[model samples]
Target: GESVGLHLPTLSVQEGDNSIINCAYSNSASDYFIWYKQESGKGPQFIIDIRSNMDKRQGQRVTVLLNKTVKHLSLQIAATQPGDSAVYFCAENESGGGADGLTFGKGTHLIIQP
Candidate 1:
């Protein structure tokens, strides 16, 4: 079974700005990593992904950085907006493949400043 401890589920953001959130993951051996954004009880949408082989990856206005040396990760959003306000989650493919689901890290609340 996948195990994660997320205490909060909501975030508040303004009209436009920037946001940064952090997550700590288990299973230092996980190879594949992904970040997702979920809006108001909706399904998670893929934002970016990084393999254990790499330390950083970038998207349109988003960037994800991984530190294998510390088992930590972070998401950086540029020009954050009300639309960008959402729940962000990090997941790892701890199972390698098949049958096992991706293990998720405790999500963070991203509040954008106007």
Candidate 2:
């Protein structure tokens, strides 16, 4: 099950299944994008990243897809597990040759069902 409120969106999946998390960014000028996963009471951990020049990228058991045209990004997790349960967020940066910092999306909570 999932819930949506003033907080982030949610996606629930059963163990052993695959999970797809989607995000929409507001910055068209952002040249870089990164996906992060955060567990309860912990900092966000980097999952993967893709540049504006690229449409897709892959990591261990994860994939990040970028659609510049629609300003959308999605993360695909190969195998759902309890450990994978967390809130996933996408960040965009327009640093443009310098580190200007990043702006993050609201995030989506990934719930793994037993």
Q: How would you encode candidate 2's per-residue C-alpha lDDT over 1-114 as one tens digit per residue?
A: 111111349899999999998887666677888988999999999989999899989999999998889788889999888999999988878765534676777788899999
Q: Best by lDDT, which number? A: 2
User: What shift in Å separates residue 11 of candidate 1 from its native position after superposition?
Assistant: 6.2
Off by over 4 Å in 1: 1-15, 95-99
Which residue window of length 10 is worst by lDDT in model 1? 1-10
Candidate 1, clashing residue pairs?
17-80
In the range 1-114, model 1's lDDT, one tens digit per residue, is 444334445556565656666666666677778898887779989999898899999999899888888777777788787678777998888554523767786676676666
Relative to the unseen true structure, what is the C-alpha lDDT of residue 48 in candidate 1, on a scale of 0 to 100?
96
Minimal lDDT window, size 10, model 2 = 1-10
Q: Relative to the true structure, how large is the alpha-carbon lDDT of every model? A: 0.75, 0.82
**What's the distance in Å from true for residue 52, model 1?**
0.6
- Residue 38's lDDT within candidate 1 is 81
